[model samples]
Target chain A: MRFVLALLATLLVGTALGLAATRWTASNRQGFSAEQAGPWIAWPKAGTSEAEPYARAFQARTGYVPLGGGDGVALFALSDSDGRPLEGNCAYDVGGAVPAARFWTLEAFSPRGRPVAGPLGRLGFTSAEVMHDAAGHFMVAVSPQVRPGNWLQVATPGRFVLVLRLYETVLSASAFSLEADALPAITRGACR
Target chain B: MIFALPFFLGAVLIAVMVHLASLLALPGFATNDAYARLGRNAPIDQVAALTQAQIAALDLPFYDRSFETAVCKYDLSAGVLRLRAPSPDTMLLVTLIARGGNVYFSVSDRAAIKGLVEVLVGTDAQIEQIEASDKDDEVLGELRVRAPKPQGVALIRVFAPDETSKARAAEEAAQASCQIETL
Candidate 1:
């Protein structure tokens, strides 16, 4: 009984000290704001009020603008330079440059920006999850059907949004220009 | 009675010493250069610009410093504009846009402001006054903000209930509310 009492006393003291220490440490974080933690740049989502302002900003800086935005569902496009379609019922193609630390990911979302359907419902494509081509190039496809290369399958037909995140990207090589010359072409086989 | 008096005095001293030690040690661990860059006098617009730049650079982390007693980070994916402050513990969902001479914000919960005076004062020196408007929703808080002088550039502050508030404000920043955007 004495041993149990001693143990209990020790536990109580330790827990109190731990709580004090944690609060002490937490009280020190003074500067960071919450919005800084997530993706800063967003492509125009259809029907949203913020879309036009972003489009204007993009145009003011770059003379050219991409296509599609007005309700229905927000569809962001990333096509090859030659006018090839980048996203399809089965997959999407993500292309951007990277430094040693930077990585890019293309995640699919429902029209409401929720990840609700797919093989994994959500697929993540990172620098570590790719089969690089001969000249240090990489390509990933998202679709329900099987393909010859790196592929993420989508099981159903629904409104979708593609989230492209480029982490630690090189300044000059981070190609996000939506001009017709800079996007990828979409490729696929007709389904029965 | 004499013995009890001395014991009581000793316990009080111990508590006071513990409190002082915590105050000294906490700031050292709590803040870094980032906090220093965002001083009270810094303009709200500049802070917003800085936040935009930082977001593009991917320097921002998904997790925030602990809130209340919990160590888990705040979730940003749930909303648009999320603001966090250490020390005084202020989280706001602020809409930032430049128009007229001043900026505006639509706050989350007016009740939460019962503690805002103490919290904002504790953390930032730039805030001059925080007034609660008469016309406020019982659920969502409403307030008009005016910051004429920040340390450096001027900016606006908006407090929100949760992440969703921040997100919606960012998405719908163009609208005119009790707080208007004017030149």
Candidate 2:
């Protein structure tokens, strides 16, 4: 009976710790601000829609607007492929878990949230088609080089932003988990 | 008694885990509800039909943020449509757009102004008004700016973003895009 009690206590403690750890992880992830986190993070601002206000303000300030259209206004979050603060001119692999929805996309943006203009396309990628990794994680590569995988090549060296979008996430069961530490971090050979 | 100790410990552990998971998922759920409800106050036609076109042309994704549904309330007396997502917890976007361009946008939170302006005017044009309205029967939003006609007269009555008004704004944006001068 003493042995049984000890075993139960051990399991109980383990489970409790696991639960507490999850909360601690979330809190820790949200601690870093844009300045501390290298300016790649963007949370939804005030408005009926997410990312619209920021995108609009960015366009108004910079004279550049996010791509796609108003109907499918895409909202993206920037992170490294390895889940860390993003750096400029570094190679990064992007991937995430997306739930079942109408459509979703990932695109590369300049640090200022504008799509990076490059030979690869329009400085971003849309959901029409995306390559996945061996683990079924939606994967895209972001770098100055044009290699395999979902590549977002930067012609010039500068800070960049990645926008992961779920156009109609309103109807989906999945939710986004975007925090500073959770983002994939990639330091390209050039930056490294 | 020893077995009871283990059971108690196990129960505590389960409780802790449940609390943590809820903490992670709660805010997201709230934000999602707010977003979905905000979109509701407007006519479903404004956003729903664009699912296909928006996805293909705009590269928009239907992210797994929350459940999406269109909500609407028809005002029988006022004969107007009230639709919105649940962000500010007050007026919806459709109310703003439906109120028309000549309306005065009033908001107390300056932080919300930048965002509110974007929603009001598809273009993030600089807002050029700052004054208090004497009319007690006015609505409260972030920043209340009076729309001016060509002659600079403030329009007294403002309408929301009805289908026609939304279409007009879109057309104007498209036209402006085409007319941009290339250096």
Candidate 3:
């Protein structure tokens, strides 16, 4: 009788432990496939067949339609360069050079993945239109109020995400070894 | 609760198997996978550009909002899929995704030999049948990809680097066409 009880306990424990680990990985599995650059993280294998089992499982669970597969990779930032969680009220500066891609884009989204468009219908900036300093460095001001230079207006409230997609770049072949300086940085300004 | 050390070891073994098994099986049972979500609005063999509002409604995690995208869900069980899109510009990309969301093949506009990007996707047997029926080299002008699955989706992305090109990008994205022929 004791052996049967112990066997049942083992089965229950094993099932719970296994399922919990799976759940945890479904949310936190990027540790293996992701490469970090400053505050941004990109899963170089998110949409490819080379993606691992955990990555595939995560995609299935999240239904993330990755930026497709060829000629591009998307990096997302949930926090500032200093590692502070990004809030809607906080102003920020995205400044620096992205890796050499034929094209790239920058946009902010609500945590739920909706575009954070302002009343003026301002949502994001494309590589060709963003302004640059005299030294040829690019800077994008992320704020709700009006600002000078390139402005990526954030209109929604609560937590948000910044997605930087580099298309037709060499990173698609070497994302596993991307340098920290290859991408831009998110610096917090003032919070309203 | 005191338990035997052997039982604990056995539990660990079972746990490992359970974890691996779940990873392999989750996609099959995932109710909200990309295929399911894309199918919610994308009808079979029809290219539909994903609107920002529709994309928001889908609530995909970490989707890029700057790029214009179109999708065509296809079922090869019935016939062959002939996908064609204009590549008048340089920033177009097409990805063929299997049902479980694995991108089996990817191509860029640079490969568009005739300024018209065309491809034929079919299963192995279906391709053989197509080759036998086409008679000439009609399907040779573009890519011929033998799909590993009977059902999948094709994604078309157009990059708009600024406001000047945003309207053009949306127009290009909407031009993708997917047609299924029994031959």
- Chain B TM-score, candidates in order: 0.24, 0.26, 0.90
lDDT by residue for model 2 (A1-192), tens: 766767766776767676565545432332222222322343322122232222222222222212222212233444443445555567765555554434455556555444564774544554545666676566667777676766667665666556654443442212323443433334434454
Instruction: Give one digit per residue, the lDDT tens place, for model 2 in B70-142.
Output: 2121222211111222222211122221111111122211223433322222111223211232356765553
| Cα deviation of B94, candidate 2, in Å | 11
Each candidate's number of clashing pairs is: 39, 59, 0
In model 1, what lDDT does residue A64 have? 19
The TM-score measured for candidate 1 stands at 0.32
For model 3 chain A, where is the 10-residue window of minimal lDDT?
A: A173-182
Question: Which residue segments of model 2 deviate by more than 4 Å?
Answer: A1-42, A49-85, A133-135, A170-192, B1-183
DockQ of each: 0.02, 0.06, 0.62
Please give the ranking of all candidate structures by DockQ, highest first, separated by commas: 3, 2, 1
Lowest lDDT sum, 10 consecutive residues, model 3 chain B, at: B130-139
Q: Candidate 2, B76: how far from true, in Å?
A: 20
- lDDT (10s digit) by residue, model 1, range A1-192: 755665555555545564464354333222122111111223432112223332322221221112112111112333323334333453544443332333344455443333423565324454555678776666666666676677666554653444454333232211222332222233444433
